[model samples]
Target chain A: MNKWEDNKAWFLILPVFIIVAFSAVIPLMTVVNYSVQDIFGPGQRFFIGIEWFKEVLSDGRLHEALWRQLLFSGLVLLIEMPLGIGIALLMPKKGWGSSACLVILALPLLIPWNVIGTIWIIFTRPDIGLFGAAINTLGLPFDHTASPFDAWVTVMLMEVWHWTPLVALLAYAGLRAIPEVYYQAAKIDGASSWAIFRYIQLPKMRGVLTIALLLRFMDSFLIYAEPFVLTGGGPGNSTTFLSIYLVKVAVGQFDLGPAAAFSLIYFLIVLLFCWLFYQALQAVGTGDKQ
Target chain B: MARIDLNEIRHSYKPSPKSDDDFALKRVHTTWEDGGAYALLGPSGCGKTTMLNIISGLLKPSHGQILYDGVDVSAMQPEERNIAQVFQFPVLYDTMTVYDNLAFPLRNRNVPASEVDARVRRIAETLELTNDLGKRAAGLSADAKQKISLGRGLVRSDVAAILFDEPLTVIDPHLKWELRRKLKEIHKEFGLTMIYVTHDQVEAMTFADKIVVMYEGEIVQTGTPEELFERPEHVFVGYFIGSPGMGFLECTLEGDIAHVNGAAIPLEPGYGVRASSLGSRFKLGIRPMYLGVHSSREACGELPGFEARVVGVEDQGFCRIVTVQFGGQEIKARINDGHPVAEGLCWLTFPPEKTKLYFNERLVG
Candidate 1:
């Protein structure tokens, strides 16, 4: 009668193990094999233990890219979270208007990442685009091609405009999930609007907000295509992030050993940060409950 | 404390209600004196909760004037009316400590910290939640969370009234009576007007000084438990307020006697005239407890009764309920455990003082 007393159930998971071995484990092992070797053409290679890792770790270019990536992700989160919540609150709650709003907001999310970069790049051309021309007319020296500051601003703005709708959609779903009784009770309790939001709406939205946070962090950390198309890691390497540098080393120069080493370190950093974020978010409800 | 009055209140969720059936609450006009504990008792969909929400200013009646001490507050919000309410399920701020949850209302109104602390402590001690005050509300058991909700409502001194919508429903069966007793104690100590809504008659009877019975969005009978038990003004009250309910038997009455199944039976002395005026649609209503039963015809001589055949006997621990057939009609009689088990013939009687007459669902006698 005891289900866990028998160990035969372990065999049921053999198919899952085999699939993971072929899909994830094998590719990971190949990367691991390359990270420790100095590969010069397909056949000319020598095992150089830890040398590529040391080189990738010490390179100042990798260090600069990591810093830029962190700053970009942090700024993306800071702008998107509150703006998304505000938009969600402002959205119409019911009727055909709500559907229309949802469709409009989801349009950007449906577009391919590279297409988004292309659209923004064309839209920001001062000579031919309305957005760029309006800023030039406003007498702000706004050219992404020549200035690093302008380039950062354009990339940050593009990222925010593209991703904020996803946050809003998540927050709206969370808001709708709240029961009506909580709001009625709050009104009876003489709660101000802020108190109602703080105690009721925000707490109810915590689960979705945490999901949104983790998704934004991971996706923005691994972002490559959109930035690569927009700036091409150029204008004096101002917006060069980890993913672009990794791609440049792996595909452009074809330095397989050093790029493999860089990728392994990059994977660990992403894994470590994501794990930390997940833990911190989960602890919000549990730690404060005591 | 203030006298609360609902004047000609009626509500319909439909915008263009054309008939009585469309309204959820119809033409309610009643007043509750300040500091009185009252219960609104009814079945589900009887609009008791709707009336409570209207009184607490959560829902405005489509046609009514809700007056607090003669001041019309029909358009005021719940907070403006200064009321507190406990819902069917406990609604505590889950992330807050019990102390903070209790202190929220006071803190919202910008009360001094010392006053908030003293009030919170007083209510927590009363609700037996002092030890758990420092603990997070989300981590506590359901009943403990419910106690925190009750404490939050009670902690504020400026509240006009407190409403409870089946607050004891989620509590364990054994704790229900204990919490009911605690609520009664709190009611007496505070002298605050409390409106408790519930579908269970026993809960209403035990807790409230006045029980308002509602049916089909209308107030049927409002009386003390004794009055409701003894003289139910409406037929629905007779059926809803008692276990096993009152039984009705078709009958025709002349001056001082009634004929049932072509057999003559004397009516109660004072009720004969009122009973005689009723139309042919008359019924004699009596509780099963008051229906007299005897094992043989010789047991009751010359008293007008039914000679019936015993069908079944249900021994209910302390009492026996005997079901009998008379004139092709089925009726049950409750007897004490000492009554002998009857075999074939039995006599059923209606006590003159206890029996009542109804004409078209309205009590006549």
Candidate 2:
């Protein structure tokens, strides 16, 4: 008993821990090192003493990208959450039809992110795409190719189509987890349709909805592939969210120091928001318990 | 309160019930008096729950009408029918407080806030849940949650009837008795038209003023507990209603004398005609508690006793259950603790009036 139990059980998990530390911790350490230093080449470096952080914070591009990212995440969450819940409600509760509906809804989520971007890019072309042709035929000078407003609409629509399924799937699982007894009780209570939704369905979906919101928000904020392929940050940086802008600075302009600092700031913002979301969820759970 | 009538309710899931087997609930016609407590009691998959669901409007009959107070409301939804239902499992909203769970139905109907508060408090007190009123339902124990479910159904008194579908299944064994007693008190106080469905005979017998015994999609019998005990209309009812149920042994009847394994037994006159129509498949049913055991042939000749081999003896504190094998058959005899009969050989007797005769799975009068 005093031999510390050998603890071989932890040895079984050592490989996983090592892999995660290498993938996440090592790169994070590299980013931190770069953020604090001025790098001249692969082998040469100098202490910058937070100068790059000051420069990155003062930059106007960072502000613009931050605002755009926030707006996109907010809009995506607002549109997807309720739309997903509504679709889930309309889906059949049982039988072969329910499986068919689930399969159809799950089709969009199966496609790769880059493929989704490519598909939307081709599907929204002015001359060749059905949507673009229909809009042009309606005599509205709609050209996502050259217009910032049109580009933003195209990206938003693509994001909604690609991500709304996730929320819907989560909501569907939540709805299915509810035992039929609750519905029977509601019926016996003589609850109106609205009252049942308000008092029973909504409260039951709280846990899953929190997860859906957080997932959709984080994904929308960090979205790159779809918008990158669709707009390429075109129409003078109108659709340039923070992820796209950070990539442009690090890879395009080759300013690793500022880019690393900017990346750390971006990570902090996400961390702060996620922490806030988690805190809010805990509060709701505690309040419910009381 | 209203008298509800199920008029020739014959329900089938498919387009047609081609054979008798296809009907989940065969034709059932019954009447529940106003402010009367009734129980639909049956074994699992016996169509008792199907009948209850039909009455609750969760399922519509393939043919026939459900009338409430002489008015047909067959096409109405459950809400339109104005009934309360408690399900097998607790169905309270886990996110709401115990008080709010009880107040939900009242608030849904837009009851006055003061009345809602008073009613919720009263129900909570009755359920012994006043201390848990402010606590959310999720963290409550299973019995507490079930009590909340029962309270929710009972909160609204304006409903036409309160239907309970095995509501005590999740309740603890010790608490089940308490809740059953509380339910009886509530029934007497409010005099609501209540329909309880359970497979448990004790719950049914203790709770219902009138019990409807159902088996294999048909209403075999409907009567008070005593009526069910004394005169079971069907062999299934006789076997289903009592503990250790009714023991069935093969027997043949001819001219007022019943023969079991060639052993002649006397029967009341005129029971011969009813037994004669029954083909070779005939049986005698008697409750175990009504059986008497003897140590020797001393009481055998005068009391119409039969010789049997004792297979086992169970000491039940107040009494002993002696499992006896006789005439290539097994029977249970419940005897007072003072009686002593060895395991291998014994004598048993069935009081003539207490014995029930069955022909082709039905009781012969």
Candidate 3:
């Protein structure tokens, strides 16, 4: 009777299991299959056990793309976290002004990723684009299509603009969740502005900030459409992030086996970093427990 | 410690308050002597918190001044006023150790390290938090955290006063007794001016030497607990101050006698003359404890007892409250556990000395 009851519990989960297998497990299995075989044509594949993995891991282009991807994500986190928190702190705590500010902040986030790229592409143009024409008017020789540095700057700006609001919104929610009494108590305790921020506001914001950090890290680490649309692996591949490089390997070069292996490695790296980041943040306020 | 004086303080949150109804605090004119324990007792939105905030300098009143030691400190900040406030919820630096949490206010004022340490240790010990001093404050129980918050308030000796805004609301019921006793001890030992705000009559009666009762943004009465119970200045006070509260009967004054329904209940010697000037319409207020319930006509004896139909009897462990229909209203009379309780009909006695008369919600005589 107990065995039957346990089996009945598993039966209830059959729908979820089937959905996961079809949507996730099956696609992942295809990737794993592709990663292990050397495909010449349809039905003409040979088992190549770890050869593709070895080749993909050792590729000089992949290593450069990996370094570039790390730097980009690191910069995004470094810039956005503080900027987002600062903006949230400056945002009005209540009233119509607060609502207006929230709407304005959400505008960039509402734009489609591809559209953001297209908008930035024109927006950073030297002649017709407002930002580009204004910058060029200062005679700085600003042109993203030609300069790798300019392309990086433009891409970073667009990424920051597109996603910083998410961080700010999260931080704002965290701020609002704090009871008004904490501030009242802090004022009575003679806490200075900096002390209030450090002891009360910052510690309270840790939960949402950790979420913001992990999300920004994972999303930026696997970023694709914006840069691909804006720079398109660019003039000499300066702006080519890991996702763009993976696409080049899979579609541009038609190296399915290598691309599959590279993708698995990419997923592992993001998973590893996200785990490390979450662990680091979670351990922060706890400090040394006795 | 400093004597806190609130001089005609009135406040409104609107940009320009044009009417009396717009104000949260209509008018508060009172002085709290230094080192006296006081509680602002009122229901929610009675402006008790607003009064506390105004005194602590957290809020600037729309009109009038707050004086600490007879010096106007209304324009100053809460920190500048040197006041400590414990909130309804425990407010501690979550990441800090209990010792650090206690030492925070002192440290912020640049108190010497040694003094801070000593004060923190003394407060932690007083609050029964010595062992938890090394633990992060966030990990402690709610009661322990509240102790830490109180410790922070007490750490600085220079603070003018410690204001508590329903600090025990979040505390466990069992722990609330211990914490309230601790506060009482602290108040007596330090002789610091402490103003506690609470809606609970028991908390106000026990923690404070004097209770300031408020209703609808007005200070109806300020007196010792005994005085408030014995002579409630307002109808709201009589209703709010006691468990089961005071029962009021509408009556008309006829010389020294009060006519209610068909019964003629006499008042105290000179009360009828006082009632005649106050107004003809009056209410006789009697505490359930004072109202006498008799099971038999013989028990009524020589007292001026009136006949009433018994409505219901409630056995409350230590005592029984007999609900009876007197005139047209239901009135409760508290009797001792072993006291004989009448079933259908009974006689109720309202002693002239114990009962009070009211006119227009104001105490008449």
Best by DockQ: 3
Please give, for residues B199-312, the per-residue lDDT of candidate 2 as tens digits.
999999989999999988899999999989888889888888777678888988787777889777676677887667667667888888887788887867677777889999
**Estimated TM-score per prediction?**
0.95, 0.95, 0.94
Best model number under lDDT: 3
The lDDT values for all models are: 0.88, 0.88, 0.91
- Interface quality of candidate 3 as DockQ: 0.66
Q: Which residue pairs in model 3 clash with each other?
A: none
Tens digits of lDDT, candidate 1, B126-213: 8889999888888889889888887887888767889999998888888888889988998898898999999999999999999999
For model 1, the stretches where C-alpha displacement exceeds 4 angstroms are A1-11, A288-290, B252-259, B269-278
Ranking the candidates on lDDT from highest down gives 3, 1, 2
Sort all candidates by DockQ, best to worst: 3, 1, 2
Superior by lDDT: candidate 1 or candidate 3: 3
Candidate 3 CAPRI grade: medium
True contacts kept of 1: 0.67
Those runs of model 2 whose alpha carbons end farther than 4 Å from true positions after fitting are A1-10, A95-100, A288-290, B14-16
Predicted candidate 3 versus true structure: per-residue lDDT over B1-365, tens digit per residue:
99999899999989899998899999999999999999999999999999888999888999999999999998999999999988888888998888889988988899999999898988888889999989999888888988888788788887799999999998889888898998999899889999999999999998999999999899999999998999988889999988789989989989888888889987888876777777678888999999988877678878788999898989999998889899998888888759778579888888888888888887875
Worst 10 residues of 1 chain A by lDDT: A281-290
